[model samples]
Target: MSEAARETARFAALAEQSNVGPHTLDQLQADIRRVVTTYPSRPIEPLFHEVRELRDRAFNLLEGRQAPHHTRDLYLAAGLLCGVLANASFDLNRYHEAETQARAAFLCGELAGHNGLRAWLRGLQSLIAYWDGRPRDAVQLAHAGMEFVPENGTAHIRLASISARAWGQLGHRTEALAALRQADEHRERLTPDIEHDDPGGMMSFPLAKQHLYAGTTHLWLRDPTSLTHAKEAANQAIQLYQADPPERRRLGELALARVDLAQVHLATGDLDAAADQGHTVLGLAATRRTESIDKGLDRLARHLNEGPAATSPTAIGLREAITHHRARALPPGETT
Candidate 1:
């Protein structure tokens, strides 16, 4: 082609590109980071709205022809928004909606060919599957994610933890333990000082979160030895969470850790301790409660009913408290 024709074509292409500048992309990224980091400290209802707004903005920017440099950034921002929507929807008891958002996030990640985003989205899908009572699917998704981030990172750690939980839920103790060990190894190699694709907050998995998963996995395994491990892990998770600053702290995680402690105490026949921990967890913000936490409490309740505590005064009081708190915690028209 002639130089003049080539110049004309280049100018036309550049003119067609949308006005999503680098500053705009950076701001969107920062907003997404804030949404993820503040997730544990706020209500899901508000976050859901915020995520939707972000998603819409991202979709708009992606509409017209975009500069090559802007394409990946737009995809990453959209993926992050979808991820936040998925998690917030799940917290609001909208399981199907959560799954839909998770799939959208996965697609965005694929478009960007972002390993970290893909891995994190897979972990989210695994979590939703686990809550929806599909342990096999959860295990598959978690393992698939692990393939993308084999080296130590938040995605690797989260995928491993979720995989361990899925294996335990499926009664595969060997695989569960292996996954847990793998998570620990990744954690050891993970440097908090380094900036990863997905930093702390919802995208990253910390040691405290790993302990919570360990506790949950042990509880699912239901072995006498496992109960001891569960109790210890739960305690460790609680301690680690408590050590964080107020803004850095996640109320939902603290509640989960407390419930895990309650479950451990109940399993060990410490009725008073179990009741206290249960009450403490129940006192946390109900609007922020996740399905996982609800499921854990359900297991604890069942344990209380089946054991000798069934007729004990402490158990009776605890049951009543749970019922009352659940009624208040869950939104109207929602059930545990």
Candidate 2:
């Protein structure tokens, strides 16, 4: 099909999927995939902005705060948008923003009576908590979300991703691996129809993201298998990012920096290279609001501290940049 025709078809599919009966989540997911694949140029920012407006309108309508024509679907769309925005913030290394957006998304989903979306928002919250260095909280949240929406395929995937990371953080290698396996199993069962129904509002949860999560989890476990998974995910993400618009390139860069640093350190035991990438992460973090990226950088920093390598020039430069940024944020008396 022609590009424009294909885009139109994809969009129509998304609308149709969104209008599907509540129980037909698989069809909903298929529509989401069509939208994601067809609109690679669409940035997360504009999407979130639109979602924020829609959410406001939906809440107003629900509370008799606005026009009466608003429906539950508006609320659902808002929740989805909020979730996507939170994910975007996480991608940008803005943890605080991610947490706020995720919480808002959860609240909106709850008010909308969208249990599945609420579960997904909880998963995002768990991920943010994990990145904030609260593994136990992350685990609790993930488990709670899983319990709330046990049959939701998207929730299962989200739970698996967070569970793997949280377990790895707690040093539960077997549990982490099991969770990773569960995510893989879900992926295997996934069909194009299912992918199109993705209700996350953004297409962040692809196979590459699964691999990236698995690789990072193994990295935390200090397992040799991490290198292979990281390499593959990094390569695939790179290719996809290259094909994407400039605005979306940051996600790929962030992911690449993460896997590259991890793989390089694993291969050469080079703390300098790891620190360099960690520095890159820090730089990216300053501009974006993603807790996950910041967490990854913090992990790399810890690794560097544990190792014996002298801080490379790159590392020192990054440190200087971070120091300056922090100083700027400090009150005058606190600056010293």
Candidate 3:
């Protein structure tokens, strides 16, 4: 076949892949990666701008600046925006920001009567809460959100994943595994047709997200097997982020790097590398102020203090940096 024909065929395949159902953050990102890779010369900025505009319009409508006639479209747009922003925040280790955006999206979705979108937003919020050291809250939110959406929707999958993480944090291994099983079962039932019914806001429900969540759940459970799952998800996410523009993709890279370093250090008992990664994540957190990254850093610090890793210079440096930063941020008398 001619080169042009080959490119056309490749693009077609990517389009087909992008059509896979139950849009999740991971799925949408994977689709974006597939499209950009297949058509390297294509202008991605335009697409990003278009989606962002839609989100802005939706927010405007929600604020009553725009007529209510466009409520559905606005809700859908907000949902999509939420997914995009949440994914970006996750990539950048700004879990708190991701949670806030996701919550806003879900509220808009609820007003628009988009149950699926609301569910997805709730799941995103739950993940943020879990990462921020609020496991009980995560569990509560996930359970509550699941009631609003279909069992097989992307939202359900997210809720299940978050639930698993919360359960793991609560030291309930069996419950966490059960949630994982449910997530897997939902994945099996997914289809391309479901994408069309995605309630406008939750667009990309990719398989990589499933792996990412599974890996996270395993991490919380402190199981070695979870490392493999996380590694697979991180690799896919890293590839997708690399395929996009740097400004648009830095968050994903940070997330991939954070997870990779965390797992590796945990496995190898290398406190210094883990501490370095924690500090790197803190730098990212400075930009987004996401609670997840902050809490993760705190957790790493605590772990280092308790283990042989505490003696490492890198660990000490990270701890000092965190303390200094926190101390500087507080009022004079509030310093502890």
Best by lDDT: 1
Native-vs-model 2 lDDT?
Answer: 0.59
Candidate that beats the other on lDDT, 2 or 3, i.e. the better one: 3
Query: Which lDDT values do the candidates have, in the order given?
Result: 0.82, 0.59, 0.60
Worst 10 residues of 2 by lDDT: 327-336
Per residue, candidate 2 scores C-alpha lDDT tens digits across 180-204 of 8888786677666555334432434
Per-residue lDDT of model 1, residues 83-153, tens digit only: 88888878777888888888998899888878888889899889989888899999999989877852335
Using TM-score as the yardstick, the better of models 1 and 2 is 1
- Candidate 1's error at 305, in angstroms? 1.2
Rate residue 244 of model 1 by lDDT. 90
Q: Give per-residue CA lDDT, model 3, range 86-123, as digits (tens).
A: 64455345556566667666766777777776777677
**Could you give the candidate ranking by lDDT, starting with the highest?**
1, 3, 2
**Higher-lDDT candidate of 1 and 3:** 1
**By the lDDT metric, which is better: model 1 or model 2?**
1
